[model samples]
Target: MPSAQDIASKLAYITGQLTAGGTNAQMKAWYDEYKKLNVELKEAKAMQKKNPKDPNDLQDPKDLNDPKDPKAT
Candidate 1:
């Protein structure tokens, strides 16, 4: 599986392709992948929100990587 950055970058690429008039088959494939990434992103965000290490204060992701994050560091 690709990293989150990989997935995100590809999603962006696909979005551009769609806007630039890619074939229907290609558009459909990319859109499906984009939707999958959206799901993963949503799950990662939800986990972070629900199980924050510090409810009152949160550290930047660079300083602290939450284990619950689905996006592998």
Candidate 2:
């Protein structure tokens, strides 16, 4: 099975081919593959989000830099 990046690359390539006047058969094939890959990528992302490896991996509110702070200068 191809990784998400690989699938994305293939989808991009197919899009370029279609834009360059690819045949109908090629367009159909690529559209199906693109849909499959898009779903797979979304599912993978959802799973990853559900079970992150590190608790601290989440965004931290303190990480934001306040622009109005006098000491920011």
Winning model by TM-score: 2
- TM-scores for all candidates? 0.52, 0.53
lDDT of 2 by residue, 1-73 (tens): 4444566677687677767766788888877877887887777566557865534334445555679988866
What do the candidate models score in CA lDDT, each in turn? 0.67, 0.66
Show the lowest summed lDDT stretch of 10 residues, model 1: 54-63
Give Cα distance to truth, residue 31, candidate 1, Å.
Answer: 0.9
Q: Tell me how far the alpha carbon of residue 31 in candidate 2 is from the true structure, in angstroms, after superposition.
A: 0.3
Residue lDDT tens for model 1, 13-43: 8678778877789889878877887887666
Between which residue pairs do clashes occur in model 2? none
